[model samples]
Target: MTRTRGWLAAVVDIVLIVAFALIGRSSHAEAASPIGLWTTAYPFLAGWAVGWLVVRGWARPMRLWPTGVVVWVATVAIGMLLRVLTGQGDVAGDPLPLSFVIVATISLAVFLLGWRAVVRLVAARSGRRGRGRV
Candidate 1:
């Protein structure tokens, strides 16, 4: 069950990251091509992978403390770094403006951490109900 949950968490993270890129692209009226989406998403996905390794997320993938927080930080930090390094910023010749960084940080935080919070809350409520029943 844990192994399955770990994989599920990883998949959910990936999906959310891609969705972040997709939404950003759409909002900016950029071409919604697969290549563009992949270009935008891969850096954050790589950061997420790094976070999983750092946290050994498979052990407790659903934990909001170390796992989710580390993943969220890493995804934003590393993702922004990569975007700047690769010249993929919102504007040409100005890789990684302050506004873009701020927006990306907040947006990715919401995307990466929001669902885990919801899941944790739901699970807690369900567990409480089960305990009361027994």
Candidate 2:
């Protein structure tokens, strides 16, 4: 991928993470203000950054293997760990509920990996078309 595409992929990932936070907040009837969204998003965003570094994702930003899967796992794991450490919870005593964890795991996987899958499919089709043309 070109540098521009790599950066764009990173931005897309960040936007999706923020979207996840927004949806969660809205569903819970929590505040939808910027500050509220930031509070919910920062942990996951931090995790994403870590994942990018760990995988050097810029080298292959669109790959669904180590890049997408590792980033997805890191985002959820680190995000939840941070939330627990910071005492953020759905209920008074449960900092990380099993139901919420499951939902988050599935939601983020779809959000993060789903886009890459679509991009790969489109690129594959375009490549085939280009080859047939020349």
Give the number of the best model, judged by TM-score.
2
> Model 2 residue 120 lDDT?
99
Q: List the residue pairs that clash in candidate 1.
A: none
lDDT of 1: 0.89
TM-score of 1: 0.94
**1-134 in candidate 2: lDDT tens per residue?**
37888899899999999999999999999999999999999999999999999998888999999999999999999999999888887586777899999999999999999999999999999999999995
Residues 1-134 of candidate 1: C-alpha lDDT, one tens digit per residue: 99999999999989999999999889989888999999989998988889889999989988988999999998888888888788787576677888888888898888778898999999999999999984
Q: Judge candidate 2 against the unseen true structure and give its global Cα lDDT, from 0 to 1.
A: 0.94
Specify the highest-lDDT model's number: 2
